[model samples]
Target: MKRALILAALVLGLGGAGWWYASQRDATGAEADPPTVAVTRGTVERTVLASGVIEAGTLVPVGARVSGQIETLAVELGQKVKAGDLVAVIDSLDQQNEVLKARADLAQIEAQQASNAASIREAELALDRTRQLNRTDLASTQALEAAEATLAVRQAEARALAAQRDRAQVALASAELALERTRITAPVGGTVVAIVTDEGETLNASAETPTIVKIADLERMVVKAEISEADVIRVKPGQTATLTLLGDPSTAFEATLRFVEPAPPGIAQNDAAETTEAVFFNGLLDVENPDGLLRIGMTVQVSILLERASDVLTVPSLVVSRGDGGRSTVRVWDPASRTATEREVRTGIDNAVTVEIVEGLAEGELVVAARDSDTASAAVTMRGRRSVFGF
Candidate 1:
């Protein structure tokens, strides 16, 4: 009786222990299988991310070559203009006076030239008369010499006058050009984005040309993307890119990368190593803005496409284990055996979110995305497909 009783107690204790162990496993969610996601077919793109700004492809600043008070502002801000269109007019009273002075100087020189010519003619006639008289012995040699001297003086005067006339003509042309410069015109066809000098404002262009207005071609734009030095090596000209404006992020603007600067903007080649700050190179991309929605100085998100794979078997990048030998492996799940098998896979493109499986994977086959932990096995999302596991 004692032996049977001891056996019964041992059996009861074993049963209770098993029940407690099973209940604890279920309560902690350790009894649940690991989260698995099916291999999906989708597009995978490898891109370099960057931040950029939208700028006019062709930006030109209209300035005044001659300094004066701005007399008229022809166009307002946001006004569209064509090349050579009148942008602004400066006060031309002083320039007009200068032109008049030049004209007067030219006229005086011309009159002097005419008078010199007349005097030369008279001297030549007198010299000829003296030469004839001397040939006949009617005039002294002194008279002939004096007449020749007078003729030479008059010819020399004519030459001097000719030089003066040339000088005056050049002065007149310069004055006219100065006057024309008072009328500022657009150098390129674009929209007026800025007005630096308003009407009635005095501009001092003696040291540097003062800008009157800013114009930009809004029909097409260039995105100046700042790519880090680490990523600049992968970017190249003629690569396709996509831009999303901060204001309109839902719409993607397609662009073509025009060029990537060899060095950072405003940083000289020799000074690159002198600064401890992070360096970034500019990548230029051309985008068409037919609707005129893109504005200058607008912020943009840039993505430069480096590689792409279409309709390929893909899985979450987290599930992939990479070894030092460049071998990639994944844990494939078998529903019938309730076990996961580790298998090697060839990966084509990895964009971090999804990785393309080139070999050793098939569609509809489940792969362990995360280990069976209370926190990890609850949910797994890959390429818009969600897997939910129950404890």
Candidate 2:
């Protein structure tokens, strides 16, 4: 039922638009009963239009590396922060205890090494005495060998104790680093846009770093536009573009195209009853936001200028019918004779609405494009429904 009503509304809207268009074509003016416009030298531009969103060009997602309960959240959402500023603090009691334990272990190893050194000295003295006795035939060869072996063992033990102390020192340093990491600091200077975790929130960041906050440079804004595949070829980097927000269509801002994705994706637009699969290429435009009027995810209309001609003789392209080859004719109105006559003219640039007249037309000449007769007062909507807003 809902779909049927929507379809009916669309049909009615289209019919109304058609009636309104035909009526406007018949409206009478000072000279005739049809709508006519004068041929004049002016500038005409052709543009490709698209819809997009305004986003921060540089956005940082701050995350926690270690898992612990959040002890202090220093910055709130929308808070400005500088690099190295403390943003959050995690529980550090366990890490601190680990550091203390590592220190104790290192100290114990050092004491053991000292004792082993003393033992080595004592054993060396005994080996010297045994060697002297053996030289005098007072000690057996086995006694000398035993004393030498004891000294060697003591020295080996000292070396092993030194290695253990070195490893313990490294462990202590690692533990200290872990303890310092409990105090999280800002990576860059920006405004905090989001705060995912709060004080007392436990974060398990083992599998992946859990986002604590989001920071973004709001001044550097970019527009992510999706251009239809049919019109994407006309758009390229370095093209001038104009953007208008959905809410404020009258206010426009200028931008420059910076990037266009080569690999276009299939975009799926879902409706209540059907789905539309469209191929679109992604484009990026760098927009200046000094006034801060734009925001993240705000919908904007993008118009990319493809071609522009200045001081060119232009006419409504729709009324100019084309013949064989390069021949085109337009119904030029003569104000003096009050008659319409078809005149063949050379054409230049032609767009959906306007065409440039190269010859066979003069300035101040009139051509009937539509009629301003009945004034049916029907609505003049550009389309039955806008594809951008999907309504």
TM-score of each: 0.82, 0.74
TM for candidate 1 is: 0.82
Predicted structure 2, TM vs. truth:
0.74
List where candidate 2 sits over 4 angstroms from the true fold.
1-35, 121-140, 264-276, 331-346, 357-391
Which residues of candidate 1, in runs, are more than 4 Å off? 1-33, 266-272, 371-391
Query: Candidate 2 overall Cα lDDT vs. reference?
Result: 0.85
Q: What is the C-alpha RMSD of each candidate to the true structure, in Å?
A: 8.9, 11.4
Question: How high is the lDDT of residue 21 in model 1?
Answer: 46
Best lDDT among the predictions, by candidate number: 1
Clashing pairs in 2: 25-371, 26-371, 26-372, 26-373, 27-371, 27-372, 27-373, 28-372, 28-373
Q: Go through the candidates in order and give each one's C-alpha lDDT.
A: 0.88, 0.85
